[model samples]
Target: MKRRIVMSMFAGATLLASSLLGAAPARSADAPAEFGTDWHDPVTAAPPVAKPSGKSCQVTLAEAQFRDFTPYKGTYTPPEGCGERWSKVVLRMDGKVKGRQFDRLGHLHVGGVEIFRTSTPEPSPDGIEWSVEKDVTRYSDTFRRGQDVEMLIGNVVDDTYTGVIDVKVTLTFYAPSATAARPSATAASPVTNAARPATSTTRSTPTPDPTPDRVLTPDRVLTLQDGTVTTPRNSERIVAEVYATGSGGGCEEFWYLSAPDPAPYSCKAGDGPYREVQIEVDGRLAGIAAPFPHVWTGGWSNPFLWYVTPGPRAFDVKPIEYDLTPFAGLLNDGRPHRVEVSVVGVPEGQSGWSAPVNVLVWQDAKSAHVTGRLTGHKVGELANSSTYTPGSEHRVDTEGRHRLTVGGYVDTSHGRVTTTVSRSLTNTSAHRWTDGENLDALDAAWKDDQSVTVDGRGPARTTRTQRTYTMDGSITIGAGDRLRTVLTLGDRAAVGTTRAGRRIAWSWLDDTVEGDASWTLNVPRDQRHAVGTTSERFRLHGSKGCYDRSLTSVQGVLTEDRRAC
Candidate 1:
């Protein structure tokens, strides 16, 4: 069985009660009350809720699509920032009460509806607390309301459990207004005095609520072109025989005029034989357009051709195209350029121009590799390993290419080292191990006795490190080194392991030791087996002060250039 834990915190004073749970909903004569409004004693009996059969609520949507300048279904509270307020908002989901609305509604019942004024607020598991993070109000309260509700399912019953009940809440109090003077809570309802039997309702308090509305626009339009002009005038429209494919798709036409702003306007997508408006200094409509068949997807605006002049209607003549396509005389100047476009008739204002996409087009450079030998050792080649600089700083710079920095240490005492390599690669194969003139076969194995205790923790014993060595001069390899490739082997080694899970040999590259009388490890290039591991045990060497020891282990892979695996 799984176990669960829960913790709770409650305020002592009854001042600002918003930070505490509120009294349960009022009980109707026919139903039981979920909870009382007073604070319960340490051992007060909890009230029970009436469980009804079926769902508890319902939801609905008013409209689908909304355009700019056009309002949606219902009045929506404007968002803090200004932009387009959703005129019509589609209801994403609706809720319905199956049959019982009060079965689990009792959770809504609480206590101390008002306790924030005099009490010092305390944090609670239920999320009730004072606003200590910001400077604003002192006597404040927090209360929750239902935001959404749904049912849950269990193993045997599909509808045995009710869904989570969400809540929204408002904490009311006075705070310094933007102007610095104390401001009243105009959005909050005035507190009332009890005149009779008390009762609280969702309508108990009024708030300046903002909800979204819904609205939809039409789709489809017709376009026309002049047959006589070899090169259509900036204001000319030609009749097209093509027909729109379907509904719900929106069509947009874009044209340019000589005005301070030559931005295009959009038209609602619909079958249009309607007169297209043109701009002229004299205010005379510039052209007549025939129908062009086009399909419109919801909310989509396509471009069309039009003309514009300078200063609302003066000397600048420019032609526009909904879709940028090459035509013999479409552009009177006959040069390629990007233009602003928008549709007309749609409640939404004209949109901005498309990003500057170059009709012109270019190629990109190549990469390569280089190789190097793994060379390094620990502490004069012996008992303790060599310590890496403060923080094991390792870096790689291959000519003009970016340099990669790695950080780590080599624990040669244990025949293993680790470092962050620039990139990860597979070592297909490797073989070669030479430590000293004695030339002991790499297969030979031995063990050593050791002990460790951090700050007098314990002198733990183990048999992990058995060999150590050093290298002073440079070693060269002429096999593979291309300026394109990067090959860096700080220190390498190769080790063998038995199916029994025992390590046979290794090498170390770097080491870091903190504290007096501590040891580190570091081995060299061709030792082949570089596998480092740590184990901790506690043993008391002194009568007192031995329980404070701690040990940690880090692991990594070695390169083949230094040893055979």
Candidate 2:
């Protein structure tokens, strides 16, 4: 049997009630905050103090200029009194483009060696303007007063109709303190030993390769294949891997360049394109996959030289891996089941989809017969839309003990904000599965949260954020198959005042096996009016693995004139 749980809590002071097992306990009015009070404070170190022994200097490495489909390079020379030994060195770039949007990659090189690289901010919704600041303290030795420094700016993409950009580069130098020890002249040189390994004709014996236990089969290469394609299935485990290059055209085109409309597009609207890969078994929907950029390739701006010397002359973008084990049972049938992979969201005439996908399956001569099905699928309608798909599977093996696995995926989205959450529960108990059974099980949960915010106008603003959180817990069976589990987790709470003087509080309770979790938001009342204040309460409960809930509320006193008291 399978079950689905749904819970919702509003923003203001209201009661949201739901039941999965039973009504959760009411939150206490005096409960402490979970997140933190001073979270809004900047978390950066104080500025470095200038040394009294040496003078500080600021130099303009390059002035503003406009370029099109070309690289920008300039030479810089430090001024005297900057000192050979420096404490702080910073590189700053102020840039703005009119009429179009673009993503620029900038590199700082000294004596032919690339030291640092960064990308300009994505075009703002209001306009194209940004300022980038990087700390080059480690490369201070390269800033010799008599030598020339090279700055390279590579335009990755420019969408401006006229293609005009105004950019300026500046370098700030802070000399070392009098009390600080200085390095010798030889140690101050930026160049390091660059020697290649000597060529030798010595033959080395090759080590034996490990025995192969897995098989990889190419299903479909979206970039090479014109339309939908199929591959023969023959493996014990199947994995769908997708490698996406550039932006999957169509609606994705706006991702690299600023959209002319700036309004949200939808897949059905013929303007909003989404990359969705669907998998089918015997012409039935089996699983769904989404394409994400590989960190080494498209995800990162400059992979050439960052941390190590000659890091990677070229980018070798890897593919994202998704487990299709939930549908493994349907494919494990003795007969060769038909499998189909399809790519949607790409418009005609525009091939924005450049995903090279492969479906790999492992084969085992003596595998068990398996059967599985998804049930209780539900989607919640709220400011934050959430979809839940849960499934249960059982494997019949020759051994007396059978394997059972329960898994699900929960995807939540609010406008440009989206979070993907997935969980799996597995156990190998006697074939007596029942409700409330204390079956020794293993549970794993993971969540990926992403949000994109656009400010009307800004020179330096955070426009995008991506974060991930994961937790794993397990229940062990004793010598006689007795259930024994020890779980320890922490809860987070936070209370702070917003810039608008509104008292805002947020709390989260992370429960592993489902218990009563609640939070309270207190609103200040006007003492002059002698009015009693009320606090908002939120509660969540379920039997699923780890249940994570966040409640945020703003509390303030309202006067008769409609102003904050």
Every candidate's CA RMSD: 36.1, 25.6
Candidate that scores best on TM-score: 2
Least lDDT summed over 10 consecutive residues: which range in candidate 1?
A: 301-310
Q: What are the lDDT figures for the candidates, one per model? A: 0.15, 0.29
lDDT for position 184 in model 2 = 20
Question: What TM-score number comes out for model 2?
Answer: 0.28
Error (Å) of candidate 1 at residue 147 is 18
Q: What is the lDDT of candidate 1?
A: 0.15
> What's the CA RMSD of model 1 in angstroms?
36.1
Instruction: Give the CA lDDT, 0 to 100, for residue 14 in model 2.
Output: 4
Of candidate 2, the 10-residue stretch with the lowest lDDT total is: 9-18
